[model samples]
Target: MSDSKSKRLRDPVHGLIVFAETEPLDLLAWELIDTPEFQRLRRIRQLGVSKFTFPGATHTRFAHSVGVFDNARTLTKVISREMKRNEQIFDAPRSEVAIIAALLHDLGHGPFSHTFEGVQESRGVKKRHETWTADIIRNPNGSIRGLLERYRVGFCEEVAKLLEAEDPQDIYHAVVSSSFDADRLDYLRRDKLMTGTGAGAIDFDWLIDNVRVAEIDIGAPEDDEPVNKVSTFCLASKALPAAEQFLLARYTLHQQVYFHKATRCAEHMIGKLLRSISTVANNGKNVEKMTGLRKEHPLIRFFGKNGECVENYLALDDTVIMGSLNALTAASDKTISEVADRLCNRRLYKTLDVADVGHDDGKKRQRQRTITRDFEAEIKAGSVMIDEKASISIYSEIGGDDDRTHKKLHILDGGKPVEISRLSDIIKALEKKEQFTRFYFEKEEDREKAQRKKGQNHD
Candidate 1:
């Protein structure tokens, strides 16, 4: 938060990402990043439990957030240049909001990243990181709001709106949330480097040079075509190959790194651990004695009604969670004790693929639920044998460009705006959805596990 000096963050991905005193936006980002809430991200792993599989994947959300700021600023510069080239007046305030939004995007993530989120989701509580992010930025109780108010009245509101916007209101908005947004652009390269996987690599420089701004129509075909249209960020048709590689790289990472068996197994155990803790604590009895964790534990503040607020949400991070696991290994609850023991000892559960081509996603989920109900008692540490259905579609008309949900990435082919999928068969080939299911087992001596039971039933 120093006023007179420039700042530089040495990043492995972007190298020498700087916050210059000369640039007002850079100074703003510097102040925001200097805040304790923002620094808390340093204790939250970006790749979460993926570190178990790829020991090199220890990167934190703090660095990723900064890298995102760098990516977003670079993007705005490109758009600003385009605006100058076309004789359109640049929207400086809007660009500032984009850069700020990108910097603050992941501020609310909890311990172990998405794995902690999965814990809440399992308990029928849908607490999303994005919702927490909105709270941290605009909630009067938080210090980030005060910083924004000091900078300019109502600047915080503009950032929150863009972060939560359902549609791309402008190119600046698209820079933060579109399929080709700064977050994805930074993470793909960053994660590939951190995880030491050479497969999910994309020509980022070529993609950046090829991307340009254009007007695009929105809405899926069967849902009604072109209900709305607006000018936003899009790639030039010549950059189709680079875009294809980006999507394919993302797809490759999901299969190889994100969805690795040990990582998912560890995540499943954590989910069970959290559910048991919440169940015991919410019952309103001597929770500390029951769980063998402290009465003043960070997670204790996070599990009950207190978790809905930003203050308690910020109190938990990777170090706190992982550090507490050791004490939790001695919990009075047998399930908690065992799961913590496994996590601490690195005795990860085994996995079996439960994907079904014959059964649709809904039916497949229902089957797993029935199996979970019958077998979860013996699980000792996980929700069920089978993990939740993980579905990824590399090409979708929903996102801008042939990506996930947002406006499709548009390309001006023959001087007319066309969805990128229409012009590239490589991207079009990925339109089919890919679904994967896996069941985890603790050991042979324990009661029959998910995959073992499913196998016996089939026999």
Candidate 2:
């Protein structure tokens, strides 16, 4: 497999990512790698519009796919060797599926990444990345399917089963989509490494090594059947700390990096711009209007000659959106142009950190809203936004019999199985901590002016 040696990439997240040269990914995989579907990922920002906040976060799904494949390869090797030692009981077919599932886990992300989908949500569009991923795999003309055919591998079916609801008990799905799935595992590490932020740092090596396959009842609708039983790859008692570390990192990353106010502001701006364009694309205009203009369209172009609207939602990206923002910065529309200019110039909406959540928070929000309304009405400024912080905890309840606790870590202590919570106090704490943060924002000086005027009146 000299070709294996030829397919090495220097990844900023994982140092070096090596492709499988031994089997030399079949024609379908290669086709997928070359297709517009995959190539489009290169143009789609991995963090969506978050780069406006975290400049270094301009990584793409292309790199993330490669990283996931690399991680899956490593984990597969470990699991494969472990199975070989216990060959009498190990399921070889299931192991193969896990490796393949990892390789194609994110096959369906669209342009502009999640931000595009978020924008569509505002416009009554209900596309899910998972569904799109499945459609592309099932497409008869798709390259991924063709590549799998070359390997004599029913790879597309395998990916579908992993993502679809038909095979709820599938181990492949667990490895790819579960709370502790490979996607989350790799992303947590990769995102932290690339962003130079510690929020996503997880003990991936320890967690992977300690993971053990197990079945537990999670109380789904089919609880009476085997499908309700979740096949989870869990950690050992000692590795619970590692699991806690991973969860905390995920929480922190979501709060600090993923949901950072500036990042959210950029996402909001992009979302607004895309929504405006989609409204135009759906106006029954000729599809050719979006032909050469598939990438980015001037905000004015969204309006048809007759002032009708059209939507070519699929042809957008961070760069295209950014380009559009630059163009619209000088648009004739006052609010639209000002928002565009601020986004283009990095003049983000000022964020006020409101912490209290009771009546005091209610008063703060009311005052902020009043200030924002005044600013919009008087100065016509769009820079005011109020950011309130909120957090959501995911991995709580260490010993409850539910899925939250049933997805418990296991340890082979003296060859005997034991729960991880019995070993790690940190995991115990992580289980109960909040995991999400919320922010509210509005224009800056206007809020200050309103507050000053209110103070003067009170005095």
Candidate 3:
């Protein structure tokens, strides 16, 4: 025991977490606690549009970051004894990298978080948080990269790689990119604790304590079969419920928080607003240019050119967006502006639950057609426009073989390394499940109007 002083964090889930006698676990905390990039997390919402769906879900990324820091610290301690035994297996340097990776994993997340990225990717803009995160770390112009440089911890690329877990992804998967990662573990417990929702709760402490280090094939040399690269792994028994709970929590959060109808409506409206402004800027208009703006606020400059036209976008909390609805009750551009107003005012869009409808079913296709037409009518566009506007989840499984969870979770079963799905029935079950839900936006009034006009064969 190093007689380390008490560092208690009044966490929502675990109550007061006292890192007593912990060996300088404060390095990762200190590195992220005050950095500009980390601090910007204060400006970003965690559930994002979900706040509109669940009022209690108004937590920020700052809270999530801190929660992740705590989880990473716990994980490090859980494996500390193991790390100590195999000096070459889990060295101080690698442990430090894991901690840092956990701390800064979500640093590149911009305003409105993934919603903004979804809209951007739909427009053929190649922006990903991982890429932007890496850029910020190595960006010579940014404070974060500069701060890392100051500490001679300029391994931003490696940190980013761990955060990304690029390729043969099983070994580095748990660091930040998987269901059992620190970020997911922290958020599920933290969100459940904060929202008075037990649906996403998990025994994080148990999971952390039980984590094991196993030999993984991170391009191991031929003679290294006995032991290759040692990476974080867990037990086969823990694998089942741990993975089930993790995936189920993910599904529930998406349903209850991330894709709440109101939040989706607000995000959709915001996307429309940005699209309109971008059109104005790119169409040879003299309206202020949004060029070079951060991906979150690229429309800010275009809307007013200078001096933040939508101070609301800056002050645009969930409250601001809601308030904007009330303010826009009498505004011009009734369609676009009204949608914004309605979103802010809680006049939520109608949701069509497609969970019962399989992908290629005729009824599902009919429902999709109906919604597509309604969206077109609402925006006063044709099928082509609706086609252009439709947003799709960026399935990493472009080649079919590489699925989202295609990156396996490694578990050390009785001292032999195996893929999680191979050893755990629950993990195998998760492989067959769809962990995400898709929501299509169509105002009720627009749908009714499109329905009435359908009998007239109106193009």
Candidate 4:
């Protein structure tokens, strides 16, 4: 790539995204961005169906990917400088791998982003978007994999491994997927700016500036030989408040934007539309036969016998799903057409927060579960269709499942390392369980019917 070929692009959320030929990593990133796989991100919305709620949230994954890459570059520079100051070696290849992983993190998201993943999950498909991302990165014929291979012997594999890391203590791994990772930092800031939410006011610049690599004990016995010390990311004691603010911002964003009631309803409706299309397409029925539409549906091949080929997966995007939905509005099948029409016209399903409707303490919580299940059964058996959508838990625990666990973020207090919860009561309180299960109905009358059934159960 020539210097002329590498140009800086202006971004609304992240200012200037520079691609300089002088910097090897930037040149490589530019090459990767030029490939078809990365370019496909331009067609996938960062927040699926969120535009229905927040008009300005039509930003694509392409922009988010570039923002993440820029954030990763900053984080890497900070960590590398700190390492050099401490007379430690900062591996350039490892840094490059982290940046590339951050850039391609959402590469395999299907049309409408997580909405398609939800549909796949409902169909008993265990493979998540991350799995597809890994597959795309490792696919020999994939443009991304080929580009990475030209950069280094095992560059592609290293990037995939970094993304697949489950260890909470690995600083490099955390940089790409932790609670305070580049991905979170970019998305929080970007989403807030685009949605006009004004909810995520995180001191990201202060937090990043205060980040330092520290050797902390991984909770091993003090007397153990060679002491189980690991190099992890930590915040200065003075910046502890900033970290708390970040967590609060994330929680608020989840509540106010990501998990907004209307957005969730739209997501559920799209999932239903996809499910209906896949069912009809896979049952030896063509789109023309089912919908009488003489258009080339992008989903036909993928939903056919050989389920989800690389070519089919690569060809899918938001436009394809939107086009299919437009065609389905006239589908011969009433269910398919109705669902598609609802999604197209923004007639989102009505949602009822079941968690707030009933109260059960202790082991009696089983009663709440019973009531919810009974309500679902009643609705399913009635003249209306409903889908149960649960909000992902936003709680941050000291040691919990997956990457979002709070154990990843450490704080240095009086030169002693401790979890952020130990330093801030606000953060500790944020760890409390906060999740809700919402029942979605296709029609207002159905929602009323479900509400009456809930009242009868309570009575």
* Candidate 1 error regions (>4 Å): 1-3, 220-226, 305-307, 355-383, 395-407, 445-459
Note the residue pairs that clash in candidate 3: 288-305, 322-344, 325-341
Please identify model 2 stretches exceeding 4 Å from their true place: 1-6, 24-31, 81-97, 165-168, 199-201, 220-227, 284-314, 330-335, 356-390, 394-442, 449-459
What TM-score, computed on C-alpha atoms, does each candidate reach?
0.89, 0.76, 0.73, 0.89
Tell me the lDDT of candidate 2.
0.56
Query: For residues 38-88, what per-residue lDDT tens digits would candidate 1 score against the true structure?
Result: 999999988888888999999999999999999999999988988997799
Over 247-300, each residue of candidate 4 has an lDDT whose tens digit, in order, gives 777677787887788887777777767787788777866667676455345676
- Residue 151 displacement (Å), model 3: 2.1
Best-performing candidate as measured by lDDT: 1
TM-score of candidate 4 versus the correct structure, residues matched by position: 0.89
Tens-digit per-residue lDDT, 1-459, candidate 3: 233465666867657655544445464356456776677777777777666667787788888877887777666665666666567444556666677778787777756766666655666665677666776666565666655555445566667676654553433445565435677677766676556655744655556656666655544366655433545555445555665565556546555655455566567666665555445444534332222233243344323334322222333333333433443444343444555555655665554443335554455445455546556554454111232222222121211223434234566666776776676565566455333233334545544554454323322
By lDDT: ranked, best first: 1, 4, 2, 3
Give the 10-residue window scoring lowest on summed lDDT in candidate 4.
396-405
Shift of residue 57 alpha carbon in model 4, Å: 0.7
The best-first sequence of candidates by TM-score reads: 1, 4, 2, 3
Global fold similarity of model 1 (TM-score)? 0.89
Error of 2 at 72 (Å): 1.6
